[model samples]
Target: MPSSNKNLSVSVIIPVHNGGESFRRCLSSIAAAVPPPHEVIVVADGDTDGSWCVAQEYYTTVLRIPVCSGPAQARNLGARTATGDILFFVDADVTIYPDTIRQVAIAFSCEPEVAAMIGSYDDAPGAKNFLSQYKNLLHHYVHQTACEEASTFWGACGAIRREVFFAVGGFDNRYRRPTIEDIELGYRLKQAGYTIKLCKSLQVKHLKHWGVISLLRADFFYRALPWTELILRDRQPLNDLNLQLLSRLSVISIFALLGAAIASLWWTALLGGVVVFSGVLLVLNAPVYSFFVRQRGWWFALRVIPWHWLYYFYCGLAYAIGTSRHYWRQKKQLAFGN
Candidate 1:
């Protein structure tokens, strides 16, 4: 029987690897949340830091993998053991609000047709560093502004009905790393005609600190490349958060901006192309900059511009590379049948 709004049970599943202090705070929040979850399942994905032992302090169900499997496998393990109507997936480095679980329950109960829903990070991140703040805040702004009818799912603070989750085959275990596993699962759910919503009000606080090198590495290899390949593989619609129309325009403009700057050395007239494309970029992304300004004033927004542009540049490069690689593999398979 479909659970009623008042009686919906939530099982909070957290996957951690070397959780450290953030894990403590994550568990602490879960322990303190009013109307506590029906159960808390912590999956330690090969934690040598004794995060699994620490999880025992909270009196929640803890599962441990001998070696580090990716979060997708860890989450799948936790989901298999969860006994609640709603399987709430929270990252180890993120802390949820006191009413997060309650809100998930009410949302599902009220809308029986909602198979899954994902939430955004709060505007105020736990880390105060520039990159950390910019990255996390960018995430918050994007989710806050995105369509309510979501195209992809987020693992940071996402929930799915237990039955619906398994019906779509859960997180693809083939994703052995921390990449776009959640997004892939969301795509599959939608393909199966399941409804996934972006629940903006159900927010969580992100606690991970981001360094520039780490940010670049994660964005290019772990994120952009894999996601681009996934989109081409599934022929996805570019209607999701980062794949929106404005972002595509921005990517094209950045490449054009680069082309003009490079071509200007031989022909001075092409220098005008650089200025033109720059203006196009600024106009295209004015809303984002304005949102950043509203969130953290002019100085912070100014700092975010270059970093944001660099992000688009790399995304464009990744798309080109991934597209080439995907087709090459397709051609190889057709010929070699491997």
Candidate 2:
């Protein structure tokens, strides 16, 4: 139970780049929260789109970085200036629910052991495109169903105890982009024996639109590669969060089936392999497809299935390249040292 005398205050930190209307909407949502945060810090990381001006429109403290520093650095700067006991990190493209801050405070109050916690995007994404829906909804489903004792943290709507965050050195500035910074911080917290929880009940609406190519590129380069590097350096088990045993096995099966399909000389065998891979992919992602069907209609789910399969294929390839590169770099460095 929370101590009667200690009131935990929250400081909401938002990192902005070039977002325009989305940034405005995000600030509006934060302002409208029932119990507003103790402070709202908007760190402008070289915004040429006049987003900093929009920040000035709200009752927010704006930190202007003339150079285009990434979200990681921007967030760290915000954390440094935050006066609250809890630091809430919200992205510039997400709209929070009115109860988000209250729920976060309650979470910290109720569970003194939890060092950090993350929430997911709601099913109703603000983007109307099909690719946007597929990407955003898939994220929502995974985060909602993930283990409560999560292995990683998300920057979309994650909060950390202010002191604990500083103790773990906050977000690693090496991640100049939005990729894997929060997860890296989570790994450090776990290494220091702190618990991070996934609160699915607290949700935000994502405003960013994702194209198919951009999504694939982000999956491969930004996420898979960086995440693989982090795991390699930390030497952590891959059985946590999204990389559970069943999910790995599914990725393996899909890869093997696809490889066979590509290498087969006979057209009939190639066709058979494609059929087998499709079956396995469908089986592995049945629950995800069902979730989509419920959120949208069956027709939307059917339309998205092919692209999802392609997504898995590319992600598997990315994992392969990332792991191989990690090992090769380690070997090269060791050889040079010797």
Predicted structure 2, TM vs. truth: 0.96
Maximum-lDDT candidate: 1
Question: What are the per-residue Cα lDDT tens digits for candidate 1 across 1-338?
Answer: 27554588999999999999999999999998989999999999999999999999999999999999899999999999999989999999999888888899999999888899999999999999999999999999899999999988889899999999998899998998889999999999899998999999999999999998999999999999999999999998567799999999999999999999999999999999999999999999999999999999999999999999999999999999999999999999999974
Candidate 1 least-lDDT 10 residues = 1-10
Model 2 clash pairs? none
**Per-candidate TM vs. native?**
0.98, 0.96
lDDT of each: 0.94, 0.88
RMSD of each: 1.2, 1.7
The list of candidate 1 runs beyond 4 A from truth reads 1-6
Per candidate, the number of residue pairs that clash is 0, 0
